[model samples]
Target: MLKVLFAGTPDVAVPSLRTLAADTGHFEVVAVLTRPDAPTGRGRKLMPSPVKQAALELGIPVIESDPSEESFVSCLKATGAEAAAVVAYGKILKEHVLDALPLGWYNLHFSLLPDWRGAAPVQRAIWAGDSVTGATVFRITKGMDCGPILAQSTVTIGAHETAGELLERLADDGSHLLAASLEAMAEGRIVPVEQPQGAFEVARKITVEDAHLRFDVPVFAVNRQARACTPNPGAWCELHADGDANGEPTTLHVLAARPIADDDRDNFATMLANRAGNGDADGTSASSLNPGELLVTKRKVWVGTVTDPLELEQVKPQGKKAMKAADWARGARLAPTAYVK
Candidate 1:
């Protein structure tokens, strides 16, 4: 069995750990390293990561630490590990950590390297509207995710999958890559390929300001942005009243959505307004309000935009439980030209 050390935190790391432990007789994970328990949620309770929970369940010891080289490397070396694997560890591996292992450390990154190389990968790919994404096992060089590739596997993004859904799927993609790579390593046959240098783009971390949506932007663009932030730093749109009345804008969380339907789509093919046609069934008014603004609301919610309208199938309106947009319309306190900013 290979004497291995594992370092990672978050749900992203859970899959690899589970895979290794499930097959423990082949690849023995000697120790697990993760970030310290952190203050989470509004209550600020100290919470363990999914990785920590899983490791403890399996009777594995976990070391929580900061990004400092000595702090990370010393704990790692104590495991006397032959190889190390990292996934979403939230720390940069310094040169000493890489050299400390007999076999260099490897990282399982969410995106195809040389592409989405920074903080968020699955979200970035979907936000950018790329139809393809994959997992990359690479040699952990001293830079960012700019390491050479050891193995990779690609998967398709469905037409209406949110970022959270995609990441859940890619967790399996990452599992397949890691297991195959480790098996090859056990047989002394795996080879590392260098990452191509140049023209790399940074996947900036999502900030609170990133949640704000501008209605003036194209419909498709805004749609992509919303779903990318789903289930986390959620993509949010604000509503301003047609008349005076409000304390804080109406916050809408985009959950489930699809492109405009055929009937509405045909209407949008020319001009995406007035399709619902003068108060269809619900109290919502219909007219070509400016794109990025609400157009109709009867059984469903439709937001008009420059290219096409978006049908919000599922969402959570401000201060309300998550419910179908259609259901919310019956009692919604909104009026015509209520805009989503």
Candidate 2:
């Protein structure tokens, strides 16, 4: 059996640790390396990373020291680990730390090699409208996720899947891929192949500003933006009373949304015009809903985009709990011309 050291931090990394620990016949997880406890929650109490918690449950030794510390290399050498497996460890491994193990470290990245290489592959893939994305297990080199690939597995992105939902699936599926690659490495059955050379996209970490929704963009673009940021720096927009430029804008978090079909858009527009008694005799007009304009009915809420409107399914207003979009509109008692910016 190959003795392995595991390095990881988030909940996404837990599955691979569990898989390797359970496969006692082929692998023995000697120890786990993870980030130290950090402040979390509203109360700001320090809490251990998910990987550290899992390691404790599995009765494995854990090293939470920074890799840059001089003693970190010594601590790693003491674990008697032959190689290391990493998943979202959230730290750079310098040459000295890499040299501590006999076999080089392998990292499980949540994207195909040479694509979406960076800190936020999953979110970037969704934001870029990638129809398919996958995981790659590669030997860790000095460059960021630029190592040779040992194995890869692809999965289709759902039409309306949010980054959080897609990431959850990838984490579960990629755990098996990581384990298989390590098993092949142990048996000397696999060779790492260099990634293809070419221009590729980098998935930089998403920031709070990146999650702000732009209603001026096309409906599909708006939909993608909202999905890409869901459940994390969540998609948001500024809500102000119509023509209330001097009023303080409320931040509205869009939890779920979808593009309105052409027919549905027309129907909604006509309904709004009829409610306001502003349409022609046939309740039809050549005018389109201006971007950011809102049309809220008893059962639904739609916001205009460049091309069409996006239906808001769930939303949270500033300092308010999440609720159905229609419910929020009703409670706020917004004007007929209310819109978001």
Candidate 3:
């Protein structure tokens, strides 16, 4: 059995921990190092990490620390770890920490190397509109996600799939891949391929500003933004009134939508809604409304984007709780040609 130290945080890392723990005799996970407790939910009580919870159940020593490179090195030295496995560890690792491990350290990243390198690769890949993405297990190096790959597996990014959904699939697949990769390393059957050099894209962490939608751009770009931001800081845009007419202010959420073929527009301004597409009971209707215009049907609220109008399935007003867009429109002051921000 190999002596190992596992460092990780969040649900993404839990699957790896489970595999290592369950395979008792084959591997001895000496200790689990995770981020210190964080406040969660409405009451703001501090909570233990997923890794910590699993480690406790298995009777493994658990170390909770702030995810700093220095702190990680200190923890490793205490354990005299022969090897280390990291998954979504959150903290950036330093050269000394990587060097200290007797057999060295490895990371299981959510995307293929040199493509979406850095924190939040999966989300960034979708945001960039890439159709294909995968998981990679590589030797941890000084640079961010710049390491020699030990093994990898790919998966398709469906058009309407959410980031959360993609992550769930990847996590389940990657855990087994990690076990096999580690198994190979133990038997000296796997070879580490050095990463290729060149101009590769890096995944910048998503921020609040990234969520703002630009209606002036094409609907395809809008669609890309929406797909990229699914199940999190979602892609959003304003549904302004058509030519400053009667009504109060309102906005809509493009919860679920698809791009119509002929709605392409070099100029987002000229794009108009024609007799409506599919918006359903959540404030969408079949009506000949201009682009960026809004229609209230059956007391529901729908808005036309730079492309065709989308059915606003979910919506929320400024300083209000999120709810069905139609319900919100009905309660708030809303009417035809209502401007949204």
List, in order, the clash count of every candidate structure. 1, 0, 5
RMSD for each of the candidates: 3.6, 1.7, 5.7
Model 3 misplaced regions, further than 4 Å: 66-74, 237-257, 260-291, 299-302, 316-322
Task: Order candidates by TM-score, high to low.
Answer: 2, 1, 3
| Per-residue lDDT over 147-227 for candidate 1, one digit per residue giving the tens place of the 0 to 100 score | 778899898987778888998888877976887787787678987788887887778887757867655666678778877
Selected candidate, larger TM-score, 1 vs 2: 2
TM-score of each: 0.89, 0.96, 0.81
Q: How many residue pairs in model 1 have overlapping backbones?
A: 1
Q: Which ten residues in a row have the lowest lDDT in candidate 3?
A: 266-275
Which number leads on TM-score? 2
Regions of model 1 farther than 4 Å from truth: 67-72, 242-248, 266-289
Q: What's the lDDT for all of these models?
A: 0.77, 0.90, 0.71
TM-score of 3: 0.81
Please write out the lDDT profile of model 3 over residues 1-341, one tens digit for every residue: 77788888888898998898787766788899888888998899999888888888888898776545456677678886788888887877667767888778888899988788877788888877889999999999887888899999999998767677898889889988887787788678899999999978888887756876554555556666766676667666655444354434344455554454333321222222222333233343222344555556553444545645444567655556777776766776544546554
Identify the runs in model 2 with alpha carbons over 4 angstroms from their true place: 261-263, 279-287
Poorest lDDT segment (10 consecutive residues) of candidate 1: 279-288
Candidate 2 global TM-score: 0.96
User: lDDT at 143 for candidate 1?
Assistant: 87
Better of 2 and 3 by TM-score: 2
